[model samples]
Target: MTDGDARLTDICSGAAGGKMATIAEYYAGKNVLITGATGFMGKVLVEKLLRSCPEVKALYLLVRPKAGQSMQQRVSDMMTCKLFDRVREDNPDFHQKIIPISSELVQPGLAISPEDVEKLSGCINIVFHCAATIRFDEPLKHALQLNVIATQQLLSLAKQMHHLEAFIHISTAYANCNRKYIDEVIYPPPVEPKKLIDSLEWMDDGIVRDITPRLIGDRPNTYTYTKALAEFVVQQEQDKLNIGIIRPSIVGASWQEPFPGWIDNFNGPSGVFIAAGKGILRTMRANNDAVADLIPVDVVINLTLAAGWYTAVHRPKSALVYNCTTGGINPFHWGEIEHHVMSSFKRNPLEQAFRRPNANITSNYLINQYWILVSHKFPALIYDLFLRLSGQKPQMMRIFNRLHKAISLLEYFSSQDWEWNSENLSMLMSQLTPEDRKVGRPTKHAARLGQIFNILQLTYEPDC
Candidate 1:
């Protein structure tokens, strides 16, 4: 076998045993405080921990009341989601261990009362910070407020936890989008996070919006810029806390735990896949060779949990960074993604699809615009014409236009490749037992397979 293959084999063997042992020791009586427990990744993290590490003492979730739902009600409803079905089946009373803390991260001191802070400081052993705004077009001030400032506040809180073993921060792999190669180590922030926060504090929304493009420079959106800043903020707490950062790229549906193809929101590539499958998206700008570094939620959570163990047990001198990605290790390109997505839709067509989910990813702007005019715009025009003739409203064109706008915003990510150095991820895998590796490997494989199957089955139906 090649050196890398031989190493993978050894690592897989070790993971099978070590993973369970680590879980047994680390979670036996430990309490974990998690933010963003309502988000996609955060939900999976909570589910996996409760299911696999049953002996974990307690889980304190930092939740904010949304709409009319109380924090406790939200947590209760969250437990009822299909994502936790497996966990529910495995441990029927898992919800009893979850403790919801009502606090808004964007507020000063995360809006936590001194009493709540004191209680957490004494009781919590680990903290998983997973909250952030993922909107590509989010306004600069709000993005920075939630992504960067909230992270700083959380770090300050983590430093107060007397029994804290590890503080794991979830970040996106696209944090450093300007670079082709992304390393596990944190890159110096473009501008100091604190300085940026202070400067933005005095500026109004319009002013911040006007300067965002110039400030971000080559990075595509505010999401990535603020994420990079958050990483730098987390690194600042390295001295007092056992900090670990997990950067996951394009999180998609669940792999194995709850069920395969269990996706809730229309964010990131999921939106693109769903829109295209429904025949709303017809043309997008993307390169065929660009690596679609889509990692499943479960895989990312698994790696995050593994990192938590390593950070707590080893307590490395520097903060541990895990580039939890599958692109380099199991490369898949956007072209293949397009092909599979199209095929999946064909087999299992969504209800009320606009037209057959036939689309192309192109690099040339003129060609893309041409296809948009001919294939997308023309079809909508003709369809609208027919609808008008039949005495119906012409809405198809408007819907296509909105989908076009959404796809345009996502094209940058689809047209590029990111090289993430995952040495720490490999190292963590090496520490797992052979059985644990066998279990975890299937989760990764199932996630990839599910994505491919969904893409092919949901995007390529004859009547889509």
Candidate 2:
């Protein structure tokens, strides 16, 4: 076989049940490059690396200028965030290790200057590809631009790194939602990426939007469709690169590491939790029996860092796919998440709730619609009328409209169950250092973790 087609060598010398090099030890003095360092997961990975692996040489962050702030200012502000508070307390000078590089993922060559490119290509030992548009409603063109095309570009840049040992690409467990059972392997892309890319290059945004539904086929959204394509794109270079892919399901709040119930945004379950807490959301459509598959952010981060070390040290024969999920191990369900969230909020209670904190989920469409009309629309209409009578701007109806749209997107995942084969998670966990393995157990945190999936119902977030 040619070099590109060479399969894995399976260096199973100590592949299982052996004391291996600690994650921190392996990261010592390594020059790591990270994209999306300002994002939720990116920030946690940086802090974990700094706190857990203090001897690491430096962290190069690829950042784009945003919202009237330079990349440096953005990184600086990111350091002051509450999420990094623990790292700050541990090492007051932790900010020194972060070096922000000016770059834009959507632009050509990632908008990196020749000087920055040279610096990264010469010294960077590993790369964490974490940046992507996670919005479920993103247009096909925009989603493909960031999720697939940008990934291909990053891999090209990884090819240029003279010392690069591992490339860890963060993907979602729902990328292959079209399939009911997901394995720890890259499935064939729905269509040839080159063909899709070339065909769309000449089309305008309007044309792409019209054909998106037909093109995406069984996938629920453009985000998943493009992400699945990205995995394939990454796999094409496995023969030449030491690569690891992390597929985490419904990533929720931190379970233990960094702290419990630490979530920054109102995306995902966080919104639903917050909305229900405020007594605004009283009903949702979800299967009472479907597995929630909530993986904590810290757990995902730990798995990611460990995967990086494994890919570099063992030099996996081909790309390794870690299905970082709770499906097989803990198997928490949507009904449980709903029960705990409502209980937590009812016990503590949100201040100034519109009504009382009472929410329920059902699987039947007619029953859900009846409750939505009674518990959601009617209340919102009355509240809006009250506001109008009081001379305040009428808004509750508009809020409900947005909430309906948001939950409509979420119900697809919540109302059904997908069997995610997470044997790879166990395989990788067995190889981790004993200390790392202790804090990263799924069953260990299940008690509290079952309640911390705060999916916001009404919080308007850009990434929603």
Candidate 3:
């Protein structure tokens, strides 16, 4: 057999669970490189690595200065954040193992200096690429630059790493949203990514905007389109590198780790939940019966770390795609989420509520639109009028408008369900030792784990 065939066979075989190293042992003394160490999921990943894999040699975080804070300051601030409190208590000197490397994903060579690149290429044993613009309204040009171009650049840097054992790329499960049944394999991209890049290079913003609808076809937005393209881009390097792609669906707050319902940002359903809890979002376009594939942030990180270990140890000939999802196993619906969120918020009560938390999800287009006017816009109008009469800025209406736009972008996902075959995910779990599998279990250590597996252990068993 050819070398490529041999590698493919090895990946298909996976690792023997009985003889595999423990999660902590696999990570010991490894120099790990990570991008997006400052993101919501990235922060959790870093914290878990430090607290769980205490003996890891070092963590090289790629960061760029943002919001007036230097990269060092941002890293320092991140280490001190409440999320890392458990890790801090466990090892106050955890920060010593974290080394910040300056780099920008949007620029060529990821904007890394020659010396920094040389340093990374020498000692880095594994790479976790987690950075990408998750905004729905992001311009096509900017999205492609960060998601596709930057990924290609990172893969190039990975090639130069003499000691690189695995390169794990974080992708969205929605990347293949056009298909109802998504198998654990890279689907053909809508357009040749390079061709699309070449075509868009010369087009003016107006022209590009005009044609985006046609280019994306059945997909919802530039975010999913670019993510799909990015996956394809990552696949180009699988022949030479041991790579793993993690595609998580609807990442939610920690279920049991640092704390239950510990979420910092208002992205995705977080915003919807927070707004609904605040009694502001009363209605949203979502299918009541469709599966809500909510996977906890901690679960994704655990699976990612496990994938990293597997990819490094087994050296799979083909990159294994793990469809990290919850609906397939433990199905939850938007209707249930709406019910639970409303119940929880009403019980606990947000500081101030616009109205009682009574949010509803509906699939009917006209019904959703009607509720948007009655439950959302009308209240905002009244609130804005009240503010205007009080000689204050009429901000409620503006907030609703932005909220409307965000909801519109997200409705496509919530309104329908997709079937993702996560057999690869199960295989990875089987490779883990019982102790390794229990690392993120809530029983022994709530600080190190959240009740992630308790949810994922139940499988959806898709035929695909």
Candidate 4:
């Protein structure tokens, strides 16, 4: 067999042993820095590192004060969220290890003070960059500021870190959405990063909005465009820094660790699944057969830590890129997702559901709109009428309308799939010990199916 075939076979076999031990061993006693710790994936990465690698030195989290809260207060509240229940149980004082630094990525030099920089440069061993603007409708200038410029600044800091072992940048699999098949290697960005940043600096928001369609060309939005540019910027550090990139497709709920079906935000498929499960969304435009590419958060985090280990240990001449996706290994279609989501909700029904969880995806726009009126609007209207007759406020229809709007914004991802080469992911897995593989196998595919079944059972349960 060829080396590639041998690597594939090893990964398939390692699936039985799990991969957590190697990851745990690698992160032990390492001082790590993470950005975007308050976001979905970032939170998971922080929790997993603390829970699985408890001996790690410390975790420096860059956080900006929001609303009226101080940086310390925000980080404290974030740790108390339900998402950290597992970690709390395992290590009751896990929050003590998280050092919150007041730094805003959009600010000049990412707003990191000289003292904080000195501290990081002296002690930090690894950095995970997970911060990015995921908004599909974010203004071009704002997205570029957060995604592209922030990355450039972070690379400069990484260069200054005397003890830095690896720098992992979390990028989206859809960064190169214009192409159907995406390889592990970096592609030349559509526009030069500096040129785009300079042009947007002088343009007004209205002007940027007006020309966004033309500027993006075949790509759908500014989010992907900025992400692609960020990848290019990260690649520039390959010669001097031990860098790795993890491009995960649409991130979803936890498949195994912590708990099954644990999701917090209303982005990507999570919003649609929750909206549909609540019986609020009835029709959406999507290709049933298109690969959904929905990866579990735990799987992505696992691959990320593994990549960090590989970059630090191997120090390869080329920057490693790991396509953390499921399509190539276990292809699942939107049609199946729709079926499972509806079934799950039917069993574990939401607090207040609309007409049973009966949403459908379609390719034809007209058909979808027709169902939106008949299946969605009509039921909501009838439900509102009943509530009005009972002297109650009519609110169900309004909520369904908002849900429909949210789903409409997310259909673009569901209607298409991007193929990613994961050769590096395979290589990283190969370097793990047999014991490590046993703990990080990700429950295989059975756990995912079981979670869907449990969701269905909960939705339809009479008491629920």
Candidate 5:
């Protein structure tokens, strides 16, 4: 560990040398506020907290009505998901502990009702702000509304909370991807967030879209750019609030917790795994040796809970950022992932493959484009023609178009390497009690990955 991280451990432990409470003990009887409870990581955070900290007083979920479902209905449906089966078995009335607060993150004041606001201000002990627009192509103005503005509003609300102990913000490890090396500190913003927000408010949509490129500068897209700004916004509140920021890299499948091989966070490698298993994706540009940095969702949640406890209990003077990545330690490469995935598919292949399971990756741009034309477009064109002749709507080309867009967005991260210093995570884990870290040694990533891949055979989606 670096001197900075070693010092952090000391601050977390202190010189009293007293017996510290375990993670569950600290969270007992605490009222927790969680935004984005319906999201991939947010749901896992909720499940883990309920399961690990069984005595937690209540969970207040900030949710919105979507697809005609009310906030209460959404929370009710979420509680019944297969993801919560283990929690259900452990505590059949787990639903009683959840209280949904109507909130639309993009709206002013988060659109939270006055009653809900008053309720939250009086009893909330800890908060986890996990909501953000993760779309790579999301418009800059809309992205700012949800990621930056909503965060500011939430921070303001936290100031009113009489019992609030800690606030943990979720950010991506690629927030500072412009740099080759990233440390456990928020970098200077690309542009001042307040200034940019002020400018965008007066401009029209087209003007904002055109100026976004100049504003974001070297960052790949609005997602990373805005996430970087959100960190700064969170940092600004350090004096008034105990804050901890967790930056996770390419969140992958669940590790051992409720169960191994559960696949909920499918936005990462699972897309490639499923598409390739169904024999759709054949080739893409990726550096074979680049560290993939696929941190499991379960481990990320564990680290998140640990950080929440540390920030609330130790009360660090400065806001601590935890780069919750696996690149620096237990390094895994893209080539190893492709090998394991392909091997698993061959053994227990998906029932319906568009072609024989033979997919490869390339580092060369020209070679990848060549394969895209020959392997991707050519197959889609032929398949669409067959469908047209059979009186079926030709849809292969549309699917391929979406696949190409996804690949274009993914290749930037896949074709390069970024080093994230995760000493803060190590320091946080070092202070946890044995029960908090009681899972079996999980060094056999190869086997764990094989289990995940084999399970994917049963989960191949026909839709792109």
Candidate 6:
């Protein structure tokens, strides 16, 4: 074995003998504060914490009432989801440890009551800020409101916590997609966040839309632009707080922990995979050799929890950034993904496929458009006609239009490549006890067999 592997093996063996405090022991009796507890990655983090760190004092979740459901009801519904099954089986009364506070991120003071603020300030030990709008099509104003302004608000609140140890912010690796090589550091944002927010607060929507192209420049969408700003904004708090930033690239299904092939969202590549599996998406633009850089959700959470511990215990002078990715180490390509997904779906076809699970990806814009017209538009037109003759609503063409728009927005990322330095990720892994490092490997043999059996049975992610 290589030197790195040997070192990891020694760490694991030492952990087996209880040589040091494990991650769970470090979190014991600590109160944790989490934002975006209702989100995809957020739910997984909560589940892992509850199961792995069972002795933690309590969990404070920031929530907002929506669709007539009270904050309490929403938290209750979340605890009962299949995602929390392992936690539930481990401890039926895990709900008792969850304390939900009603607060709106966009509102002044985060819409958090003074009493709730006081309560959080006294007892919370660690904070994980995971809430942000991940939609590519969101307007500039709303995206900034949630991604940048809310992050600033959270940092303000973190400053008041008497016992707060570490603050962990979740960000996307594509935040600086304008660059070819991204290091583990925050780059300068396109425009100052406060200036942009101040200038746009009074402008009409149409005017802002007109100027967005020039404002964002090379970044394809507002999502990445605002996220880049959020990173810069969070760094301003580095002097006062022990902070760590995790930037994940195209989070995919679970690798082994909880279960393999466990996915719950259609954002990023999930939508592309599902659309192709259902035979709805026939063509997309992507460089075949471009690294897919899809990190597993469970792995991201593991690194996130580990980072929180390291930041709190060691108290780094500056914020440490972990570019949680798979490209540099265990690189996988878009073409390989397309081939695997298509092959899996063909052997185990979707319930009602529009056509066979055959997808073609190309780097040429003209070739991709040509296939879109012939393979996508033509098939959609014929299917809609059949539906119309059968006395049903003609929806196939409309669906294809929406799909086209989504794919068009996504092509910019896939058509190019970006290099990310992950020395921080390796450094964090070196700190994990052998037991923590070995959590998911044993289950892989069983999970892989089950994964092939289930194939591409994806869970529906609510369209945000």
Task: Give the residue spans of candidate 6 off by over 4 A.
Answer: 1-20, 438-464
Candidate 1, residues 1-464, lDDT tens digits: the string is 34323323332234334534455467778999999988877887888788667788999999999888899998998887766776788789998999999999889999998999999999999999999999889999999999999998898888888999999999988999899999999999999988898999999889998999999999999999999999999999899899999998887776544445566677778778778877877788999988888876766777788788878988999898888888877777888888888877888788898888887788788999998888788888999999999999999889887787788788889887889898888787667865455444444455468577445432211110
lDDT, candidate 3, 46-103, per-residue tens: 8878877788999999999887889999899888777787788889899999999998
User: Per-residue alpha-carbon lDDT of model 2 for 132-208, expressed as tens digits?
Assistant: 99998999988998999999999999999999999999999999999999999999999999899999999999999
TM-scores, each model vs. reference: 0.92, 0.93, 0.90, 0.89, 0.93, 0.93
lDDT value, residue 343 of candidate 1: 78
Q: In model 5, what is the error at residue 191, expressed in angstroms?
A: 0.8
Candidate 5 C-alpha error for residue 458, in Å:
7.4
- Model 2 Cα shift for residue 80 (angstroms): 0.9
Estimate, for each residue in 1-464, the C-alpha lDDT of model 6 and write its tens digit.
Answer: 44433432333233554445566777889999999999889888888788777888899999999899999998998887777777888899999999999999999899999999999999999999999999998899899999999999999999999999999999999999999989999998899999999999999999999999898899989999999999999999999999999999887776544555566667778788779988989999999999877767777887888888889888999999999876776666788777877889888888788888789899998999999999999989999999999999999899999999889888888888889998897777667655555532223443333334324654443532
Task: For residues 53-145, write the lDDT of model 5, one tens digit per residue.
Answer: 888999999999998999898889888777788789889999999999999989899999899899999999999999999999999999999
Global local distance difference test of model 1: 0.81
Worst ten in a row by lDDT for model 3: 455-464
* Model 1's TM-score against the true structure: 0.92
Candidate 3's TM-score:
0.90
Q: lDDT per prediction?
A: 0.81, 0.83, 0.81, 0.80, 0.82, 0.83
In terms of lDDT, model 2 sits at 0.83
Model 1, which residues run further than 4 Å from truth?
1-21, 385-393, 438-448, 454-464
Residue 357 of candidate 3: its Cα lDDT? 82
User: Which of 3 and 6 is the better model by lDDT?
Assistant: 6
Off by over 4 Å in 3: 1-18, 435-464
For model 5, what is the error of residue 337's alpha carbon versus the real structure, in angstroms, after optimal superposition? 0.9
- Poorly placed runs, candidate 4 (over 4 Å): 1-22, 380-401, 434-444, 450-464
